[model samples]
Target: MATHSSEINGPDVNDPAINGPAINGPAIEVDRLTVRRGGRTVLDGIGFSCPPGSITGLLGPSGSGKTTLIRALVGVQIITDGTVTMLGMPAGSAALRSRVGYVTQSPSVYSDLSVAENVRYFAAVFGLGTAEADRAIDDVGLSTAARQVTGSLSGGQRSRVSLACALVARPEVLILDEPTVGQDPLLREDLWDRFHTEAAGGTTVIVSSHVMDEANRCDRLLLLREGTIIADGTPADILSRAGTDSMDEAFLSLIRHSMAGGRSTDEVTS
Candidate 1:
């Protein structure tokens, strides 16, 4: 069995001090979250909180439950136990339908439609106007290709279209799963910049990726292995605690320590 460490600054959803005033509580909170698929536990007692206006990176290899966790947060996955609250309401509530934006790993767009058309469609679905949809298309650097047919665009361009649709709603919480998978280095950098811009504007951005290099771009990181979070904290904090200079090294150090049956580096440091 894999052991997990408690979050250092766990937010209290009920306490006004944590949830009141300036709204000091987290934008998303998961408590003892567990998920099962096909009779096997995919996520085991996971817990964490993503603060408002922050960029949280979920880092884990394939089948590490990164996708599953993201689905749970978006209120799509059925969990066997635990709870997920987003913006003070239960995950997947009807009210959250417009306040939360989700972009899956695979691009979900109409191949026959123009890039701009796709964004416009989703924007309307979210009750947003045409201007919002146009801005979102530009935000993803797809303005020049907005009139191009989605099927004629490259894989990277198609992916950006999906991202634009998600951004069109301008949701308070944005969840992206492997969004940069097929993007070029320049496109990836631009997308990261956009993510930070959104966070600066008070949007909580939770992104999931298997790439360790992207960890440094996040305000905080949650490192998972086999559904268990082994490290959770700022990138610099994780490196300092793990005695590593890089995110990859930090992950390896934590993995080695866990394999040795020792306390998680995060726990020891906390």
Candidate 2:
């Protein structure tokens, strides 16, 4: 996927007035994070840290607890144990509300409202104005559908509307759960570009996807299987360490090694 660096007309990430001082330390830190649902542990002792101004991909198949981890980071999911720290504060802190933007797997926009109306409503909730709303809509390539009712839009368009709501906040940390599930190849590329642009501007983006191919676009990757982290490292490093050319092959190799009680290649390198 191509990464975009072009300026979008929202809050200037470089402006001190908007971003404040350059943030030090990891944008996200998770230690022994665990979550249980329906008497079963959904996320078991997951640990990782995402550096500031980087794009991290959470790659796994469905039922691998990708969404659960995202919800935990955004302070929505109830965890059974462990801690998630966001930007040096505890996850779900009131102060982090506006600083963290989240887009769920399902669209969260109001179906009765037009796309523009939804953006405006969310912007207001974020204490922002119409200019921010408009910029968000434009950033997601929804300018043409701005006036259409969200319910009348296609699945992909509605998804974009949800994304627009998140972007309007210009959050320092963005967590997206399967944002490109049904998107066409072109739109997927465009969205990845937008993510890269946000990261370039010092935002920490954690995106979850089940697609192994998309893993290549991220700066770092956390491979998960059945609620456990199987590998964590750069795509190139993972490939090299796994002795494979493709992420799919690399993932399988890592899994086999993990099941055989061998340390992950990532562990050896780190």
Candidate 3:
């Protein structure tokens, strides 16, 4: 766990967050959600809710069910049991088709289309204009590549184009799967800032990433392992729960504690 600590980000104790969101209901709610893949359980009756106007980080090691959990949230994965509701409707409700934005691991853009064309098409699909399309491209740091074809771009650039397409919609709920997997430090920092800005504007943003350092940037976190939740709470809450001030040390302690047969639900609640 300590060696893997290099992959995650830390928290800021002095960072202040706003209060009193206009909408008080949970943006997403999962009740006893379960998923099984390849004759093995991927998510074992896991449940949690993400509040509106907040950034919730879904983090864990490889194969810890992070991708599958996020897939369920976007209504693209089949579940054996449980219910997922977004904005007071079922997970895959028709009403949410335009209200929820999902960015998968693979870039979902037309390879032949230029960045601006790709984003503008999505924007138009959502009844938006060129301003919104341009804003989304800038938000993802792809302004210079606006006229470049996506297929000729590098993998990272293509990923940014996909993100731009999603951002152009400005959906009420945004679900991202490792949005910054191979991005450089400067771009990663810029993208995280964009996420914070989106959350501040009342969008429920859920991001899945392998970077531990980014965990600190989230308002709350859901730590998972082997299809079960190990810990769930704010960064400060998680540190206090693990009896440590360092994020890396705290995760090591919590993982050890969970492996020692004491993964109680009480430890997951705020």
Candidate 4:
């Protein structure tokens, strides 16, 4: 949303700004990813790829491994087997230090610092300056609270601070986990708008949400259920394949099919 010519770069081959074209490939790729925690399977073998300029929504109910899957993509979660690659490099590689931006469910800003200060800190990590931080704050509609102490802000405001921090870096891949949990509908819409802007700029965006309605905003959807991916496709594809107009119904239908021990013909991919 905050377009900085030099800083907000993408992996597009047609982009005239960058010297060499980015390698033509999916922004993210996973193959048979599996994770086990405390001897319990948290994520079954899963594989998928997220192309640049696309918004991939991770949809599922609580304990559906959405958060766990996100953690794996961001390189924070340990996997039992399989591989996750981001921007052509392995997930969590030091080479990906500034190329990937991740915002967790919990706000990761400093409560003792002001909103502007918090964003400036993260911007500095990416070798950015004050102007970039302010633009990111404005992108999230938090310019008015720039000088306010982060601890004094409301839950929703604090969440925006976290989002701003992530946006400040203008990463090639933006991963958000339940970013709109504390935000209002209007703020949610604004945030999703910003997400679209990022995706349109060739940033691979991965947004995790429990709300099925948000799936419509994504170009592709990954519906996870009980440590497995039940569906993978566009909103319409998922609905059409499930033979239902309602996303909830589609999810239920897919889940039932999975429980019946049959792989979704065009649903889950692994």
What lDDT does model 4 reach?
Answer: 0.88
Superposed Cα deviation of residue 160, candidate 2 (Å): 0.8
Report lDDT (Cα) of residue 175, candidate 1. 99
lDDT of each: 0.87, 0.89, 0.86, 0.88
Better of 1 and 4 by TM-score: 4
Kindly report which residue stretches of model 4 are placed more than 4 angstroms away from their true locations once superposed: 1-20, 263-270
Cα error, candidate 1, residue 60 (Å):
0.9
lDDT of 4 by residue, 1-270 (tens): 435553455444235354235557888999999999999999989899987768999988899899999999989998999999998999999988898999999999999999999999999989999999999999999999999999999999999999999999988899999999978899999999999888767788999998778889998999888888778888989888888899888888887888888754536332
Worst ten in a row by lDDT for model 4: 11-20
Task: State residue 54's C-alpha deviation in candidate 4, in Å.
Answer: 0.7
lDDT per residue as tens, model 3, 1-270 = 843452353322122343333444688999999999889999998989987878999888889999999889988889899999998888888889888999988888999999999999999998999999999999888898899999999888898899888888888899999999888888888889989878766788999987878889999999888889889999999988888788888787888888898877535567
1 or 3, greater by lDDT: 1
In model 3, state the lDDT of residue 46: 90
Order of quality (TM-score): 2, 4, 1, 3
* Candidate number with greatest lDDT: 2
User: Alpha-carbon error at 51 in model 1, in Å?
Assistant: 1.3
- Candidate 4 Cα deviation (angstroms), residue 167: 0.6
- Of candidate 3, the 10-residue stretch with the lowest lDDT total is 10-19
Evaluated against the true structure, the overall lDDT of model 3 is 0.86
**Candidate closer to the true structure by TM-score (higher is better), 3 or 4:** 4
